[model samples]
Target: MDDWVDPGETLETASFERLYRGALELASSVERTRAATLVLLTGRLGLTLEEALHCNEGWVDWERAELQVPEKDPCACAGCWELARRRREHTDPIREVLYEECWSPSPDRAPRTVPFGWSRRISAALLATADRYLLDLLPGDARELLRAAGEAADGIEPDDLTPGLLAATTVDFLSDLGLEADGTAAVLGVGEARVEPYAAAGESDVTTRMARLAGVDGSADPESAFPVACGTEAFESEPFDVGAADADALAERATATDAPERVPRPTDLPASVDYDPADHAAAGGPNRRTDAGSWAEGPSAADGNENALRADGASAVTGADRGRAGLPDDPSTASGSQATAPDVTCARDVVTQPVVADFSTRAAADGLCGGREIPGRVILGQEELFVLWSEEKGAEDADAPHLLVPLEDVWDVRIDDVPGRLSASFPHAVTVGHRPSGRDELAVSIQLPPAQRRDMASALYRILLNVTPMTVVDPAREGGRVTDADPEEMVLYVRPHGVAFTDEAGDAARLAFDLSDVVDVERIERSFDGESRPAVQLRRVTDNRPVTTVVTAADDRLRRLVWRYVRREYHQTLATVRGIRLSDAEKMVMVALYSTDGTPDLGSLLDLTEQELSAALQSLAAKELVRSAEAATDLTGTGQLAVSDRLESVNH
Candidate 1:
């Protein structure tokens, strides 16, 4: 069954069926090409609204029955360039650096070929949709179509309709007509085929399949396969048999019976626990407690308790508290407090020791020197590596002139022997290769002190390995023929946008997979030369082929680390594709809740007004990403995933 539904409202099965039928009828009234385009792209092919817009007729291979989606090149148009230029004008160097380097405008669209075969009706509709030129339907047109469909189904608001919602409904409608395995398998080509009782049919056998789907078998009633109108005599008279019945038949039976006991409505259910707003306010909002003695002590005593509560609930222990308790807050500090509050460690607390170095920059385009070396203190931060050149050492000022390099952009970092003209104290040179604007690589070089040289080098190596290129051999192709052995030795590079395998010199890419395309990543033990060794396995789909590759590193630790990085990258990338962008206030509230135990006084902590906090919470709750009950607000599973994605970007 299709899991996706319209976010604005949850429709009952009967209402959804009515809506589906109405939509199909409404679609039939539109221009044949437009109607076909709407139904085929979203319903059969399962392309998202954005993907459907970018699609061209030429992408479809008639002979292979496949649609080949090409990678999108970064836009060089005047409008796009203007936007990019304006984005780079931020006053904060760190923000500017992140926007330029770490952040990507869109998720990676690696070239993908999806094999698809549909019933004759769908095939004819698609052919008509793509007459001579590529289907050039606009977003407004798609919206209008969905709006009309909504209106036809008992006046659902046009504003509540979204492309994703409509597409999901269409898929569900088709699935009811017995195309579940075929349609779902074709859409999800990365996995094994789903088993069904009916033999999978080809285009020629589509007519028979359609007939079977419609319940046209000798003894079955044709109308039995579809949903019946609610409260109708025909619906009540018809006997429902659960055996061998599809979803529509079940829905029809359920709707006809008006079984409130079977399908309880949210509005009809009574509250599990009575909550009094008056009592809540008298207690001084959600975060404040009202124990018998505390409440009797009045507002003054309540204030002190609130402060104490804040101290206990706050994830990070302050310097004042550390001194008063005579216990260090650092987890590494040999103390029992670490065990008691294991989650106290925040991302900001994990800062690397600063190393004195000389920094220089070179233009990526021309490979020419952009600046001369300047003495500075280099610090490896949670988010980025920065160099502060101010004479006042040990001072960390945001406004000071500094060079910031986002960690996500640092693809490669290697230590080299320092040459002449540099300080003798800084004897080692560390070179970083990164793409600031998703263009050519910019090289940032720093000469590190001899004492902390290895420490800094190892730190960079460990943290940046996700983006660094590593030599890997494809075990499957190791003993294959010479012609098929080209991929035996390749360099694998995992970036925020995508994963790619290139030649030894990293000049030409042999294979590349979008983070979205990677369906699975696993760590497994592989036997080589009668010895067991750890390896990472990646599985992706390409041109109807489920490609699996096992990658091994020089040691078990490195391989395990690679697996972790790959999995993390995959999750983060998937989260971005959800099309959910939280506002600044929403983010602050989410992070505060994620980092702290119980609910903090969000209004005070985030400096948000009561109205603003309420609005943000409502929006989050509507999206099903957050859950709140009375005084406590917590993240739903989806909310946790979203927050984790955001935290990874900051903590990396």
Candidate 2:
């Protein structure tokens, strides 16, 4: 039985709780130095001061981090040290800890050793597994971490002693590789970390403050979040600057340069912004030039304003010698002559690019591993189709959209319907799962799109309108050929169509059913004797629709029975597949482990204490069946060897 506190135990009692409580109470009532006295007595001596103050004092260690005590020595320092000198003594050596160390399973057992080449291979394996499982679902950071773990596992030696360092290193590696974007990190199961790019161009002071505010000293739930702080700081330091030196001066200068308009003035300004075509041949001419049409909502050709900006500063200089062209070299206009300049311009039209249509096609079909098909129909559950079809190059002007067709309309099924895609299946079928009492419909494996999800109940209601009922058929007595000359010989014929038969009287018959309608047919035969050359004889019945045949031999019958048992229970022959069933093994292991406390090395299963057995079992994991229930706790205070011994016993 486990130990419980005694009723008579008090401050003077030798029980652990009593001494510990007395020390705590005594220390609290006295000064700090006096508290030290209580600590020394209870922690180092493991006894009350009254019980341990009289023991020897040579076991104390003032330099090293430990206290050495002889196996049989009853060392005590309470009486040896005077009260005044205790405070100045070196740090105490014997530290007493009360809590148990909770042991979690170690991923590996051997000491660390660097395996550079092997680590790479391991990383490649991990990457391949991740790729195969569709787990590239994490944010960039997490994805990077997974990738890093793979790399590190490949490159590192076995002797690395960093504690929880591997996990962190992987996180950092992912961030460095820019794999932390989107949602990669979380999907990859990598731990969190902070990543900052453009740090050089970024404001260091602001980032530091933000980082500090979110660090250890920061409030767990502050009034403001970290991102908010960064945003607020940016806003306060750099508000919009429309009046800055860059473009504001140009706008201001342009205002002063314009001449006042006259009531009876020409539709265009005498000297307005405009392009001159002659300037096109000149060096360093206008980088861009446009006519009235350039302005999206500008005057049209019918408007007089279209050609009125010939002298405007916006016009390009066609030639440096403008005076020879009868135009004022400076801003002054020529006397009564139109100041003309060649228009150097180009027209640019903005067009919209249509979105390219794309989609994938998946069918609701049988899974290759295990499932069933009903008559004239097949039931598929969470089945996935992965087709590799390349998208057609988009025509420059077409608006074509892609579509997905499920089941390809059942009536159109053909031998080559799913070329290169063959499926082998088991017999379980899908059905509506459990639901809340008031819930009237089942949810689909894939959630409905937003439009449909909004009214899932209604969508499901419409779906249930056309669901067909399943049909069942028996195969025995369907069709078989019987020989008239030999009453014991019966031949059964099975075809893609319903089973057919021929009686001993030379009569042929066929069942009126679809080939898909039949599931299984059993030929029941009775075996009597334990041994015989033929082993059994057929007992025939003429009036049993088609015919009936029974065999005789106990051994033959027993062998057949076992075959049927396997078909009914497992639904498949064990020797035919490669897989493991862990449920039965789990039950057996638990029984053995719990009953016998395992020993060190776990070599001996017959003799084990409860603690040893518990530890042994806790160190290992059950590997066979898929566990559907809660797991049992492990034993403590026992070493690995003891646990291993117990495990071997339980397993054996």
Best by TM-score: 1
Off by over 4 Å in 1: 1-3, 6-32, 71-117, 132-134, 153-157, 170-652
Q: lDDT tens string, model 1, 1-652?
A: 3234643333434555444444555534343345435544654455655556545443443332345554432221223223444566546432232223311112422344543322333334434444323344455666676566567667466565665454454444444444545533444231213213221333212223333443323333434344331111122112222221322232233233231111011111124323221221111111111111111112121122111111112212233223332334445422221121112122122232222122221111113223444444444543356554443334434444445666656655544322222211121245666667687666555643222333444445434442233434443422222223222445454433355665544346666665444545777776555567677876543332235667766554456456755665555445443557677777777777766643737777778999999998998888766677677777654565566556764233
Q: lDDT of candidate 2 vs native?
A: 0.22
* lDDT at residue 416 of model 1 (Cα atoms): 36
What candidate 2 gets wrong by more than 4 Å, as runs, is 1-404, 408-607, 616-652
lDDT against the true structure, each candidate: 0.43, 0.22
The residue-by-residue lDDT of candidate 2 on 519-622, one tens digit each, is: 22244442223222222222111211223222211233222322232122122212111122223333343444444433233324335556654443443343
lDDT of 1: 0.43
Q: How well does candidate 2 score on lDDT at residue 30?
A: 24
lDDT of 1 at 210: 35
TM-score of each: 0.24, 0.15
- Model 1: worst 10 consecutive residues (lDDT sum): 283-292
